[model samples]
Target chain A: MSETQQPRAEATVTLTNDVGLHARPAVRLTQTAAKFSSRIELALGNQSEWHDAKSVVKVMRLKAKQGSEVRFRAEGDDADAAIRSIVDLVERHFDG
Target chain B: MSDGTVAIGIVSHSPDVARGAAEMVRQMVGTSVDVGWTGGNADGGLGTDAAQILSVIEQIWTPAGVVMLVDLGGAEMNTEAAIEMLPADRQATVRIANAPIVEGAVTSGTMASTGADLEAVVAAAEEFGG
Candidate 1:
């Protein structure tokens, strides 16, 4: 079987912040995602459409309210690290 | 001199609003781009001041250019007046973004932090407009 290139890193995290993914958290998420070279995208729970995670506008538009499950996918050499960092950011409530 | 990235100017009718918005941008992007803000009338009342806006524009001016975000129609007019007061060369480099003050400031600042050019930064702010 021939190997096919695909995104190998994915994770889903719940937004636990009081305001969910509001402007402040959205900025943090986009900034964190921008640090990596990988292409990262996000989707709300059970939604098929994914938006660019590195765009503050797109991230803010997601409007993922508190307790909403947000999924992240990354494809590139640093995909795993990117996903890990994003997951960590979410888990930490984006305080950093 | 700027770091070659577009700068952001925030103008609001209330001084507190302008400062708060600028602080928000700073918290989001750190010092990645130059940010300046002015609000309220000369007497410290709730009104936009063209002179104050002009001063902020000059304070944060950069060769890359600057995108100004205004809170209301009056603020926009004052910002425009401020721009007109600048030298023709500077006026050419400054733009008033028709976007909400707080949202536009954040978006413009973030885009500028990535080294986006003036038009790109202005577009980012305008995208927030209804």
Candidate 2:
């Protein structure tokens, strides 16, 4: 038997920002992730380990450089919105 | 607007470092969280001054509490001394995180901006492990 799962969303976005996922971008990502109640996780490229999107320290430690692909996976009621925000933030170069 | 959030204090041996860290926090975390910083010796040299630290603590003191990040052992000691100088009641609300000054302040400020309490903010900073 298959168990029911909560709402989830996933997306992989390229880091187009000049600094990649450095301090400023990491801060923006974590702050955006915190706005949603969903549990959001981020991974670099094809890495198996996922870091909490709302954790600045963990997000920064990912060390995802420019042109790297960052995958976002969020689970919860607002998972879709969380993923959208993260993808948008990355696409916008984290300027917002 | 600053209510219900822990404040962040940055202490460094050089005044420039303290100011720059605080500025970075402000730029990254926005103005949602309060950030105060103090550095340099009493004579404007490169050292930590407990008196300066105490003033910044008092400036940013809130019921939510304040998390301090220090650059070196001297800064930590000075920050501790400054906290000790606070009234007994206020003293309990301040903490010195064992983390790098810039990273700790930024993390603490970001956590605090999310309405995190003192303990969580301190943990976020200390997670850097100096």
Best by DockQ: 2
Q: Relative to the true structure, how large is the alpha-carbon lDDT of every model?
A: 0.88, 0.90
Best by TM-score: 2
User: What tens-digit string does per-residue lDDT give for candidate 1 at B9-108?
Assistant: 9988998999999998998877878889998898879999888899999999988999998888789998999999999888989998888888999987
Distance from true location, Cα of B16 in model 1, Å:
2.7
lDDT of 1 by residue, A4-91 (tens): 7865699999888888999888888877887788999999999999998877888888889999999999998899999999999998
Question: What is the DockQ score, from 0 to 1, of model 1?
Answer: 0.38
Which parts of model 2 are misplaced by more than 4 Å? A1-4, B1-3
Best by lDDT: 2
How displaced is residue B103 in candidate 1, in Å?
Answer: 1.8
Query: Could you report the Cα RMSD, in angstroms, for every candidate shown?
Result: 3.2, 2.1
Pairs of residues clashing in candidate 1: none
Interface RMSD, candidate 2? Answer: 0.8
| Stretches of model 1 off by over 4 angstroms after superposition | A1-8, A76-78, B1-3, B28-31
**How badly does each model clash, as a count of residue pairs?**
0, 0
What is the overall TM-score of model 2 with all chains considered together?
0.91
